[model samples]
Target: MVSQPHIVFLTETWLSNKIPSSLIIGALPYTILRFDRSSRGGGVAIIIRDYLSYSTVTLPSSEHEITCIDLFHQSAYIRLCVVYRPPTYSLSKSESLITCLSDIHASSPHPIVIIGDFNSDSLCTHPTPIDRLFLDFQISVDLTHCHMFPTRGNRCIDWIIANDPSLIPTISIVPPFPSCDHSGLSFSLSSPQSPSLPSQIRDFTRVDYSAFFNYLLSVDWFSLFCDCPDIDSIYSAFSSAIHSAIDLFVPYRTPRPPSLSYPPHIRRLIKHRDALFSKVHLPSVRILFDQCSKKLLFEIDKWTRYSTRKKLSRVNDLYRHISSLTKPKLSIPELVSPQNLPVFDSISKSNLLASEFASHFTLDDGCLPSLSSSRVPPSLSLFTFFPHEVYKSLRKLSPTCSTGHDAIPQIIFSKCAYALITKEFQSALNCVFDWTQCNQLSLSASKCSHIRIGSKQASPWYSINSTVLPLENNVRDLGAQVRSDLKNSSSIKMRAQKATSKMFLLLKALPFNCPSILILTKPMFFHYLASPFWNPHYSSDIATLEKVQHTFTRQLFYRCFPSPDYPLSLPSYSDRIKTFGLRALTERSVIDRTSSFGINIELTTSTPRYHSFPVRISRWYSQLPDSIRTAPNIRMFKRRLENHPIIAHLAKLT
Candidate 1:
């Protein structure tokens, strides 16, 4: 089913009405119909691929143990049915079954395929009264049995009887499913062909960054922005410059289509299994082939687990691996309109999502009082941006930061900031909300969010035009969450929870059959699970992060080394972490992250009155040794600390 067969049918499914279709199929792209028995056991189901147009057929009441679907393929309709009859059912039932088939053959204006377990063996060779009746009916209806081999126990009890023999070329029987007696059958249907579609391709690897930078350097900044009267004009010019550079330096080429290839181990296993199946026909040899098939399946499962574990061992690689493995999620949160009606259509749903987001950030126009006088500074009105100053500011911008709503890179605004652009930017924003005829732009109120750094009482409400903007406790900016309290506890907790979930998953997925491999992979797994939380530039309470790390480490240790005598002389948690060659989430490590960001504490004239991450980091930095304190920069200081391991350890103690 995962390989996406065109159609599937099952008999003696034992599925009851109580079982939902979602539980049975679960997001597979298929339309299903089932005929469940009133009592326990003996049921049938038919599923057709979603790409094919299909509908349920209203069968006669005589077809009690049957499920049927009509498939529309290439301007022609085909009736497909699945039937199941228990061995305990009376021979008289065959009369109704034959009548149902006769009626279907007469009524359907298309080819018919009837596949099922009839519980009658060798009907063509040795016929009972009911078997002889079916044989006579088959001759009259021009039906042919497609199954050449026995479906179960040296008897052709199951069948694929089709009205048009040309529809099916050949039927191949595979081994029986685990715990099932009947063999699985596969057949290819002749269908109309369609032309292949060409796909657009881009090769980003050929981009020349050096050429791009040179192009950027050659652009005349003064000529572009000197006469620009508004922020929009300046933004337009900056964007044009970057885009032209990209167009010149980045080469776009269409490459040949990619070929699908399996992993080497899986390919080898498949080849081995095929060789065994092709050469061996003896009963003992067939059994060996079946065993080989099972072994191949097991190897594939093990390889998948091993590959997942290996990729998840690195924090940077975990997201990509998880994304590739994740199934398309169906449980989207339902959106409702203001009138309490469900939004189903894509356009309405999008509008609802936007409205919901706006509701969170928007405040009533009457919530805040208007200002009595002009609040804009006198000096800000005369401030003009210089090209040189803008260039310097842009250089300070982080290359990795994301682009803004205008599709302009953050570096552009960062560079613009050097020439007192903040005042101009605010003026431009105000112009957009002035509601005058000249107002050519409008900002999305929902997309904009603000966080107050001080006490709520001290903070004043902000508004664009008459609409007051809602205040937030924390808001994500430049890829990191900035909080009013400036503590990373919330961020750290989120990371810890995510890591803990992945760690538990790893524990559950580890193969107990290979303990040596598990032992070897433990350190890699630990690093993969824990590194993301600590690597990012965030400040968390050391004790809190340590507790989270400790919990995960303990669980991992117990799973990897599950011996009764192992903890008789219980070692310290830190010692156990060392034994596993894993790094501990210590207080010093947390402080070091802040230090790496070039935060200086000794420069502070007074102790910070408020408890914040920056204040805490400053305090930690002031207490460090002079060698670290007087280092040229954050990177150099980090390198020094890395070199003097004993000194760094002692510094943590302080």
Candidate 2:
């Protein structure tokens, strides 16, 4: 290791015409001389160890590859010359190189050492006698006199020629590094030292930080501040302002919120105006805003007139901008029809809606079905009534040992009614009618009733209100009697009781045609009297589960089911019940007429018996809708029912 050696990396030094006259050489721990030769295309470089001082001498024009490095060491001058010879084998190569070396040796005040690439075979083919004689005068150590292969073909070309053997430097051809084709050479001599390693490295030592960090954690962190006004409120205010501004850019329906009128162009104008306002030197915000609006309006007008698709708002953010300008000026007069404004038109709104809804329905040419006058919509037929005999036959069927009620006809009628009124079915009406004719009851009804039927149209239930014939009345009254009998007649009641558990199973056997109505009305059998079962949140102590059935009929007057039109379908019932419960009591007063409407039927005189029965009509007809319960009227009814001890206990059931 050279304790203080100059290390220089010379690049592109061998390329004659291709190489530059000047090159940058990095000489670590040394002083470098970056120079250019006047005659040579690639120049020679010399570096001296930093601890050494050197002086240089100018050489003759022919002397191109000559660099002298002088060092003051051991109180004497030590000079070194690093040289390079051209690659040609011509005599001129030897002449030029030898002349350059001789001139430097003659002029030098101290001994010189030359080390470089010399294309010559010295030991094997001795130097010409003339060159050998000249080199001997200096008595230099010609290291090239020995053979050391530096190339694949084993050529001795690299050499160190020195004036004296004792003053000769130690030289070794370093093993080739991966970077270059030639092996590197390192030469060094001892030198005195100054300060060695840096002080930062010497001073640092290991120390513990656990206790210090623990003390830091123990501080009362909350006490480190003074009270300040809330920052969150300010941030929220800014955020709301931004949201309001953005919301203005989105167009809403015609009856728009007072906000959302800020046109994008107008907003941009306002922002520009505000920026100019802050500058103070610019025009007033009012003037600047007016100018910007005029400019934007002109541009928007041009865009609207020229574009095929009418999207002026988006063309240049014109909607929100124009809206922003006029929003502040909005007043009662502007609300009528503001001029130069970008209001959402009906056409645009419809287009927007069509664009939004188009994804839901697939309508190709082949999708439309053939239309025929003979054909009828299923909705018309679903609700179409069977001849009167059908109901009569249904009425005659007795309750079974399993299913309490025959549900098929009822479910079918409900679905048919729904289809007809709601127009929700897609099948032909005549087909349904033809199918119905196949049934025994329908065939008998057709022979008896002679009701006019057609695929084009049919008389709806609502129209029957006007046909108040005695025969129709008798039929309706009979149907009502049948329903009432199912509820009141002891023999049928006993049969139903036996099949009560099978009622749900029977319901499954019924038609899915009027599933909505089935789902709506099914719960009424025992579900409406849900108070004790549900444990009415109003009061649990008043009614216990065991007493529920006995007390159920008493609460019937207070209880109500949904109207037939709304149907007691599960989803609708659930949603409506929740809505009714949450609404103000007065708002929820609308009566469900189907549950309440009926003539008073005194089925039982015993007060206890009345309490247990599912139906016990009050003496007074239930004339009013459920919604009309004012305090005074409610109190009056409460008193009236209370006076009747039987009703008083029933009211508590619900």
Task: Output the number of the TM-score-best candidate.
Answer: 1
Going through the candidates in the order shown, the clash numbers are: 2, 24
Top model by lDDT, which number?
A: 1
Candidate 1 residue lDDT tens string, 190-274: 7533324355444669887787777788888998899999999999989988877767777767667533345877787677766
TM-score for each candidate, following the candidate numbering: 0.39, 0.26
Q: Which stretches of candidate 2 lie over 4 Å from their true place?
A: 1-5, 9-30, 34-42, 49-51, 125-153, 177-179, 190-654
Model 2 TM-score is 0.26
Supply the TM-score for candidate 1. Answer: 0.39
- Residue-wise lDDT of candidate 2 within 59-86, one digit each (tens)? 6644456566554455566566766555
For residue 138, give model 2's deviation from the true position in Å: 6.1
The residue ranges of model 1 lying beyond 4 angstroms of the native Cα positions read 1-4, 14-42, 122-124, 192-195, 199-264, 278-281, 300-654
